[model samples]
Target chain A: MSHVQGDAKKLLARVRRIGGQLGSVERAIAEGAECGAVLQQLAAVRGAVNGLIFQMMEGHLTAHVGGQDSGMPEEELAPVLAVLRSYMK
Target chain B: MSHVQGDAKKLLARVRRIGGQLGSVERAIAEGAECGAVLQQLAAVRGAVNGLIFQMMEGHLTAHVGGQDSGMPEEELAPVLAVLRSYMK
Candidate 1:
């Protein structure tokens, strides 16, 4: 967590929001919300989680893997970024 | 919840797994795991959530707008499925 940089406050807020979203999702399902509504809520959560990943990636890239400053080669970064992209989609 | 079909057992299991994954992410972050590892965990969680969405979509589709047998026109089902597909990615 300490290693992660760039707007820690925003990241913390996003994490809290995700927790709350997950809670709502559980409640919606438990209380028997319609299938459509449940799916919508789940999708929203998915989007939120995806946003968080993007933020983390941005922060990491700026701090450690900035293209100009990083000693690591493009080939090395490519596979890592690809893995991140795969999770994102 | 009742409207969703095609495996209540599996859906419940997926939900529980997601909850557990979230807990692990939180724990890992708190324990000061490396940035790459945290991202890995978060990505894994994201995939888990996406998998849950797909399962939910399948279950809902089977019960409701199932092609041919659903009594729903293609035009009507198309947009609904499109929305689901957008979230899935």
Candidate 2:
């Protein structure tokens, strides 16, 4: 299996948390929490989803595209890593 | 501005890479690369998107939900962190 598939359990766990955060957002809205409070929860959910995307991207690049095993030089990988690191910022 | 917004440049860079990866997949298909090859590219794109999602989630949790400045106790944060760490694994 590819590295991402091998790590499916962990990835799924993260997705589950994202799901939970979404549910929290819903509950917050339903309960008529302050607008600011509900927005905070929503923002949190968005962030979580973004985080998941970042992790998947990094794994794909390292394991599938370039890695120590892939014999790709650091010089070749540097720009990609820079982009990724910036993206995670 | 929120931390995520403050880091928008980096995040956008990551998103751009994801866009580039997606385009590569399209090009691979157009060139009629072998099924396995195309599949590999597609998988990489998927992983990249997932990586982005993962990073967003972690940032939200730390910067928005709980953090050193948030004054939330580590005891309270532990379960959430555990969930996130497991998700990232």
Candidate 3:
């Protein structure tokens, strides 16, 4: 496993937070919370999820693509980077 | 706007890739790809999304929660970390 995988416990902790945020959204909807408030919570969830995505990409770049001992050539890394770039947007 | 926001271009590139992946899945369904093939592609998209989510969470931790000189104390960070843990799982 890679370093990220090795740190799964920490990573999973973050994921759980996202889930909890989602549950809050669900509850807000069910409880008839104000539309604006619900929307804000939803946006927060989106931002949090985006944060997680960014971290994973950084890890991949550091450990797999740009690591000092990485055997991956620039040509191969280019396409992966391209995909990563788009996903982040 | 912090370091991550400054690097938005690269992050957006990754987001676009996810979009493209979703498009491919759509096309596969429209073209009547074999059920197994379609399912496999869908799974790939799921993994890609999960990867993106992981990246985002890591960035939040380093930049917002644990950055050098951050004023936020561990007590505040703990609740955030707890939420993240659940989201990851």
lDDT per residue (tens digit) for residues B1-89 in model 1: 36553354566677777877777766666556677887898888788888778778766775667657678866776688777767655
Query: Mind giving the per-residue lDDT tens digits that candidate 1 earns over A1-89?
Result: 25453354566667778878887777777666677887898888888888888777856775677567789765777778778777665
Q: Rank the candidates by lDDT, best first.
A: 1, 2, 3
**Tens-digit lDDT track of model 2 for A49-70:** 4565566666667775676677
DockQ per candidate, 2 decimals? 0.32, 0.04, 0.03
lDDT of each: 0.73, 0.59, 0.57
For model 2, the docking class works out as incorrect
Worst 10 residues of 1 chain A by lDDT: A1-10
lDDT tens digits, residues B1-46, model 2? 5555655566556656655655564454445444456456555655
**DockQ ranking, high to low:** 1, 2, 3
Which sections of candidate 1 miss by over 4 Å? A5-10, A71-89, B5-9, B67-69, B72-89
Ranking by TM-score: 1, 2, 3
Candidate 3, residue A18: CA error in Å?
0.5
Q: How well is each residue in A53-77 modelled by candidate 3, as lDDT tens digits?
A: 5555556566666766788866777
Best by TM-score: 1
Better of 1 and 2 by TM-score: 1
